[model samples]
Target: MDVSKDTPQAPATAAVPDDTPPEVSRRLRLITLVATFGGLLFGYDTGVINGALPYMTDDLGLTPVTEGMVTSSLLLGAALGAVTGGRLSDARGRRRTILTLAVLFFVGALGCTLAPTTAVMVVARFVLGLAVGGASVTVPVYLAEVSPAERRGALVTRNELMIVTGQLLAFTSNAIIAQVGGESGGVWRWMLVVATLPAVVLWFGMLVMPESPRWLASQSRFNDALEVLRQVRSRQRAEAELSEVSALAVKDEQEKLGGWQDIRSTPWVRRLMFVGFGIAVVQQITGVNTIMYYGTQILTDAGFAADSALTANIANGVISVLATFVGIWLLGRVKRRPMLMAGQAGTTVALLLIGVFSLVLPSGDGRAYAVLAMTVTFLAFQQGAISPVTWLMLSEIFPMRMRGFGMGVAAVVLWLTNFVIGLVFPSLVSGIGISSTFFLFVVAGVFSLTFVKLYVPETKGRTLESLEAELRARFS
Candidate 1:
């Protein structure tokens, strides 16, 4: 295997196809789906908190500020977990790392459900955050490494699809449980407990799946890497991919791997990291989480009654899932940068309207409905365009040897940014009012759009190795 720019690389592996031997593709899809349970848990925990909060606050005796803290604690934990998880996955293997995270998710969810006070809840939520953050970084990278290039975008993005679907499930469950369990002393506990099911599923799921072949090869376990690849690929295809990947791994080893030094010394890698950071920031600044975490609140502020807001929030979840489907569809066909810019542009316009609607309409049903409409529209673009691109780009941009570390660091920035926004959104809304809060988002969206236009690279239609080479050439 001559590992050069001209080497004949194996075509990226496909998910087991429907028409192909059912034995192979069927097992592959099942493995992919099971591994992605991390994603479903990620969606459920984060989205469940949105509706569960009202009941939680009353039960736990929470103030507005404390309420924000409860919501953001997981995000804060995710920030640390994202970076640590990425590095751990890189140093360990993706399979082991995800399995560890599955345990964390189970423990954290159990803790949250059983928490007796706000303090306990926050700590427990932080633990959950760690799992979510880690999952955000690890799952996509694992999927990308395992998937064939032609189906890579779709397969990798299935995690995102699961993420939103998890959120929808959270919303639906919260609504149902709240409606049915109303007046129960701790109905919110039931909401939190639902997360445990997926966590258990994730742990068991990863037990049967192979580690990413790329990660294994990166660790110099060539035989083990080949065995894993052979399970998923035709023997010929497996050998070819192993040859190419092994060559890259050897080259990376020759260069010496790991740490802040690689990032500082390698200008191209550093530049890509900057772009990754910007993408992560851009995704958050669209105020999408504002909707995810506090959608009911936003609807209430706009004009809906408490019950109506909870119900209306479901619409947000529905649109998010649907938009993600569109996003996943677009991922294969569209260039990453353009899709991002379009998402930013659409979100920016939507945020501006949200501000205007809040300011112009008198406080009543009209104002509430108008703001709700804009939020939905904002999500249509933000979830459809910005989010999927951000995750896909982060997963795709890093070199194989440093994929976990690089993406983890980027996700740390993302989760921290989310934490900051989630922490302050209530205070900001209370102090400045909805108009100003949205205006701030509008400004952030502009900066995000500019960053994408100026720095982000197009990543579609190329192998990860080729993309790395192209980025190095352009940035170097």
Candidate 2:
């Protein structure tokens, strides 16, 4: 029952029939488009709050602490969702889990749209966070599973693209809505309801999509796995790939590499989880979400008028989308560890400049623009290198049987870290000032860079099965 775990000296490779049929390729593209709606939802739900919060604050009568609660509640919910969604996907099915999350997205959006008070909004945002956390773990894993190893990076990264794209859409929508409503009492409600359309789309689209072949194989449904593979892969390639996938699935079955028992009792798995935890921390510690959730405030604090800040914030969303596009291209051309380290270095430098500008410059347009420039630069590295690699590696590195479970646990760390930062960032800015707050992120970036060098493994140019085998051997 011992699977052929790939060793460093002898990594496995397949010389399969490379000609994926045109129809099959189209089907794969379609599947990717449909599944990534979860990601779009993730982006919109999280990003909308950045713009909506200003209006929401006034309407909901929020204090600074209550504002933090309103913002971090979804993140807290996301922390719960990461573990809950991962386990649910592992036990029930990724497709089913996403379906359930879609319903939550719709309900959560409706709740937020109609919320009469801060408490109701907090609860609604928490519900929405569940879907965000679920999609963060599930969509990439699902995309990675269905994609060809050769095209895995590009295809799976499409979800990352959609995420930023959704953010850009939110920013644009928020700006437009604000202008149209012109300081209306409930402009944020319009922002919250936009997410419901995508949620409905995700539910309907996933209904017809094929389940992950890897998931089917893990369940001992070899015939079903092969059938699903055949729909997306050429007949010869499907047969060849299924043999390797099924053998690994059987080996995993023998070892029961599916849950907390294996993660606790198996040394290799425990190490992998540790590395997974590091990866999760590395992504969050970059403080990328800080900009995403509060770019408007950051700009305003730097000296922009409130209305000016909201409009300028769209620039952050635009750059995020552009940076992610660059990240996807680099994933195909570069190794993961180097890209991640490079990203950390870039972000660290950007944070330093932001802090320096805020600390030294007078309250003028010059300093405001300087800080805005650095924030955009920070996102260039964050989205382009760290964010894509974090999600892609988490999706790639786990044993097939516990892919969802392992990634889920790691994502819990990610979401919880996000929750803490989201909750504290407002207070930090208020108490310590913008200059010192960014200095803290600069310090975190250094540690994150060191962790990547020492612990993170490269995952490019390898199939998930082969990578899993290689990781198992390395850890063991």
Candidate 3:
């Protein structure tokens, strides 16, 4: 339980040295800020439903079954989007795929905003989900490929920070809008429309950003790759890194290592895929999204009125954002596997407490506050540890040639898990009630912790190329 005890020291390549020119550093920061808008959109679209769904349910006359469909259609679409987006980013380019995803974000949000029927809204959310799933896979891979190994964890996790920030924005906006328009008939539409603005920002921001240098190298565009790398890395370091990247790119090409066949035929890759799938599943089964997509409803169910629940849910959003900031800093300091294990343990305990408080406490402010307290504590660990490590490790562990595809396929499992949880969570709460539903998650979390302890590798100190080599050797 002492996370620091027996932890391995970060290697020589663990931190970014103060050798890069300021301009190059600025460029890297700029790219990270722009690229992570995809994460921002992902966060907003998903989190908006927490508050919007209540209003939407009233307006659309949604039964629990239809509500689940509306809420989970995006997740189902995301399952498809993750794989398709991964393949698209690998085939067309990360920047282009994001551009395309941005378009989808805009169109989908608008569709939801103007949706006249339940079917239309579900379809629109499904479209929005495609963009979300695509962004989930592509953005991290792009950031991972562009970042220096030393800064990779921090830079790539900025996307997660953006994601939580977007969620906060959604939570905050939902509260304000509900307060102002609580009497209005179609207030949820306002909440849905706010997402389109960020989609615009993501599109324009990515237009000026550079493509992933590693992607360029994969296509044998070594000179183009070097130029892009030079924008973020020092002149000499960029050249040296380009050589390492290109050599791997060529080796992967010659070995024909980037397709479904490669994953099946190659023993090491097959093992790597197993680990990747486990990592993806572990992240979703934590029951984080249950809180995310239904925190307001849960609060209302506990004791708060509709308006108060909307406001209180912002606390969850705030905690998530703050925890993610802590998580980003921690990734720089600790090993990934231990951090993840710590998060899993923290969340499981919090969930158990929530179930207990719900079962034992009477229906009033005490039970509500206790449940809220546990949810906040849960977010602190979930965002700060489980999420950042999951995405960063996924972005880090895959082979360079198929980083997009591998992460994408893994994300399919992730989104599908999310989809099932989102869909059935309502029914579970309606059927088994929240306490037993969360107790179920507690059981799942124990399994998740065991998986991380057994299968997840430490990925903090090594470059992507070096890590891939290490994995290839260890698995082989």
Candidate 4:
């Protein structure tokens, strides 16, 4: 059920009740950094392709269809990776799963860097997709489980910040590499290789980090849960939080709630899954990836020369990172549902303008600048509102026992939506021209707004366990 803004409620605060020791505070910050390198990899690997693809096209002899294939293959692999990664984290543990994914990140990057054939490149990208998909699910879930209830939104959303930071890093790296090697061949390979360093850092970092206390508690290891919690939280608060989490963990195991059968059989789980799937689909249908994955091409179509388009594309990455900073601030001050509605509305208008600018303006600087303005405006709303909320809400809403699996399934839906959009966007522009293609996104934005207004629930300012109980009562 949607919570009304006027409803009586306590004031919002991100402060944990217990005072944190300086060492614990530093440890918490360090953990956030290390864990978010997974997010960094997620950003760099996905965003690097945006700049590298043009060069790769020439090097690999890609046609339009093959170009789409190369781009979409990683997304296709992500679709598979989402479910598999989620399940692995659920059965094993969050830290363990992330450590394994870091290795995948390394291997996948190396494979893509060295591939001599399009077939091999496609295969390597798919392998990288696995790491990307796994990181998306595991990193946020780990952060959510480890955070204080009051700070969960801010802490968990750090992954989203790192994601865009990685993207910016990719954009910056791509620009530098392109410029430095303007006369040389295979610069995209250098772009692809930058991702490997972070993968190595994430692997070494995860080796020293503590596992999720909630996951350990869910396994009936109460003592271990407290120990893990203490690594991030103050001793008194860690103990207090563990008591509440332990009670839920016991009830969860008693109920044995997990997987497809559990989700189908339980009323609230089914409803949450429905909501989760809708959230995932809503995010993708906005066509944000078109900008993230193919921003250079989008700018080129807007009229800039190829080299100029690559440099102009950096604006998109910069706005995404800055807007995410605003989003992290907003997540603390504003309610989530309204932020989502506002974002959708902003993006819809931006899309409408993009179509208008394309259809009415003649090919030249004016048209290009107008569309560029709209794309930047569109991403400000998207990264600030929609993307962060989508990921944070999915991380928040699932039952503790099945958080990994539930989010995995929703992420599958997200990635599949992303895959279809990535696969068809080139054809979409080819068949309909730029104006009509954006108009289609405008229509999608309308529906996405309606869905959120009526069905999406508020998840702000609550612990995951409390949120789950509230949802169970309402859905049941």
Candidate 5:
């Protein structure tokens, strides 16, 4: 595939069709709801820190470097977790891996809630990061595998919706908790503890959820795969879908398609991996997590009082949820490549404005509100377009046999990029001021936009099996 060459919109290839029974549709919706709780947890855990950090800084006596550590520790753990979780889901089945992650989520959250020392907090957050990273890989892959082709974009991106909703929940709760607790010594603990409830919900929910049908097929358990598929698809559609999935699964196994070795030796697979890595890096380098992990601090630096910033940060969370909703709807109607490029362009412009505003607007309500508005605009483009498309494309681009592993590796790159940004952002703001820091992101954004235009493929509107075949032929 000459990535620089344009990828035209693919004609929508219908999956099994809308002839599914009511019961089957209900089952599928239930599975999506349950599975996406992982995304909710992902959002809450990451976003809670945004509000928690200032309070934590007071209690822990955190230096800027330590604050960075406290925030980035989970991201570092996530980098490891992405690859480890990927392999685990591939070997142990997606449902079981998520079950284990839910347990980790509970334990890690509890640890964070009770931690008495900075060291303990970092380790605890790392543990949470592991679960977050695992969920990031497993949940979407699980959703992608089970969804019918026509509905796959909407279904898979539901996880993104949950992620932002989780963030919104964290922001809302953090504001409430901070307001109620005032300057109380341990208010951050309250913020951290709330995550435990959802972890419990996710565990119990997955206990009833079926394993990924494609995973079963990859394991050569065709009967089991078909049975699982039938829960969410009509019998005839289930049978037809299983035939296509199993054939690819068997071929993938014969070709030994599911490991690093295959990625290294196969020309097309290697090319796909390059694209996957690019996509992952592109998603992170836009500096979205800088806002997510540090939005409160950013607003404060921009001139809002700490209390006001905490409250105002809710707008970021709210817009993220709303934009993700729009992203989900748009995913159904737009081609992935163009949507992604448009998002990149929108966000780049937003970041540039934020930089310019922070630099020239002078300190006060005006600077604060301008920065806030720009952040909101940046997120609208991000959650609505860049994020959903990024995760959806990652879930779709890999081969069936190694879907989890491939996405995991790419996610590793994404988290590492995020980790670096989260770790450095506070210092960057303190060192050169907020304006220069955002200007840096603006430059990165321009590069990201060009990369997406030249390299990313259009992925919407194709069955996973057919998409894989097309990629193989195009790259070959």
Candidate 6:
């Protein structure tokens, strides 16, 4: 598809001309960087366990089933956190909600680092999961609402980039720290401790950041929202943007705003939620976490030594970060629906190949390398194509008034699906073996592709209000 090049001009305000001064752009970038620390924490907390788990199990004396529970409990907490956070952000405000989550992240990290038993670790991890879940829903929505439409895709996707980068940091740090503290009795505690640094940064950074202008408008705080827009937007543009957002907010209030009842009462919203749920489900069913949370174990199962597996897993983290960069670039240049479908296609083929390689390749040097190559290829497609687009679309598709709640509901499905996959993956691998587990992902990928091709709407180029009207008209 030919990409559109229309950069959204700043809304006309009294303090600036039609063209924004360079200082404004610089400030906006700074805001994006600070807010995205939430994503970094999200990634590190989820991925840190990949390396920490083996040591944790040894220290805590966990069984296989309990190990799965330990890994997935955080995900389950995330599922609840996503929905709760989304709703609270809508009712409260994005900045406040994130500030709250930052505290949770810090407390959760501390709890995990200090836990003395498996049961305590599970509870502590679940607390961390709440922050992760909240961040996944709140950060993207916060970024999208604050960003200019022209740079929206890139800016919103910056969070995804950071998320993968955080995961890479986790993996790299785990490797170095494990090697350095290898002889220490509580070595994994150090792995869990590393997350606290980002959490602290997120909290301090957000304290000075402005609240989402759109969110402010939703609460009828036009003056406060305008002040926020002025910080990152040119004065003229900020006033114009606030006016536009305010008009929509008024219309939404007049229409009685959002709830489950609102969704059920409105056919178009119900349909959009369904699409969102499908998008979330499809993203998870690819079995990405199987590789993420269990990549080291999978490598060991494929014949690599434990140390070799740890070293090799860094490749997975690196490729994920790189692929996310590609994905963010692609988001700016491609239609959302087609990009999603293409991602599904790429992941399907990669999963099929992974299954085939495991089934057909002989064990030893060639098999391990081949499987690793296919795993990297799968990450390239999955992270680059499917993952970023999924998050971006969820953040983009909802109406201003319902943005938080709608995205939250969709994210709830996403987190729950992730939870189920994370919970069952170890068992699945043990029960069905490697080849069949991947084959299962291949089947799910095909179904996901079909869902995107047939049902997912194209959402590029349109403003959030325009998209909502378009979807309402189409579905109505």
Q: How many backbone overlaps does candidate 6 show?
A: 4
lDDT of each: 0.87, 0.90, 0.92, 0.90, 0.92, 0.86
Q: Native-vs-model 3 lDDT?
A: 0.92
**Candidate 5's residue-wise lDDT over 1-476, tens digit each?**
34755445443335445588999999999999999999999999999999999999989899999999999999999988999999999999999999999999999999999999999999999999999999999999999999989899999999999999999999999999998999989999999999999999999999999999999999999999999989988888888888888888988999999898899899998989889999998899889999999899889988999999999999999999999999999988888888999999999999999999988998999999999999999999999999999999999999998899999999999999999999999888889988899899989988888888877877767778888987887787
Candidates' TM-scores?
A: 0.95, 0.97, 0.97, 0.97, 0.98, 0.95
Q: Could you give the C-alpha RMSD of every candidate to the true structure, in order shown? A: 3.7, 2.6, 2.5, 1.8, 1.4, 3.3
Give the runs in model 4 whose Cα sits over 4 Å from its true position: 1-16
TM-score of model 2 vs. true structure? 0.97
lDDT of 4 at 373: 94
Q: Write the per-residue lDDT of candidate 2 for residues 125-224, one digit (tens) a residue.
A: 9999998898898899999999888788889989999999999899999999999998878989998899999999999999999999999989989899
Candidate 6's TM-score reads 0.95
| Model 6 lDDT on a 0 to 1 scale | 0.86
Which regions of candidate 1 fall more than 4 Å away from where they truly are?
1-20
Query: Tens digits of per-residue lDDT for model 4 on 99-169?
Result: 99999999999999999999999999999999899889989999999888777888899999999999999
TM-score of 5: 0.98
Candidate 5 error regions (>4 Å): 4-18
Candidate 4 contains a number of clashing pairs equal to: 0
> Which candidate would rank higher by lDDT, 5 or 6?
5
How far residue 80's Cα lies from its native spot in candidate 4, in Å, is 1.0
| Per-residue alpha-carbon lDDT of candidate 6 for residues 162-194, written as tens digits (9 for 90 to 100) | 988988998899889889988578899999998
Q: Give the C-alpha miss distance for residue 28 in model 4, angstroms.
A: 0.9
lDDT of 3 by residue, 360-438 (tens): 9999999999999999999999999999999999999889889999999999999999999999999999998999999
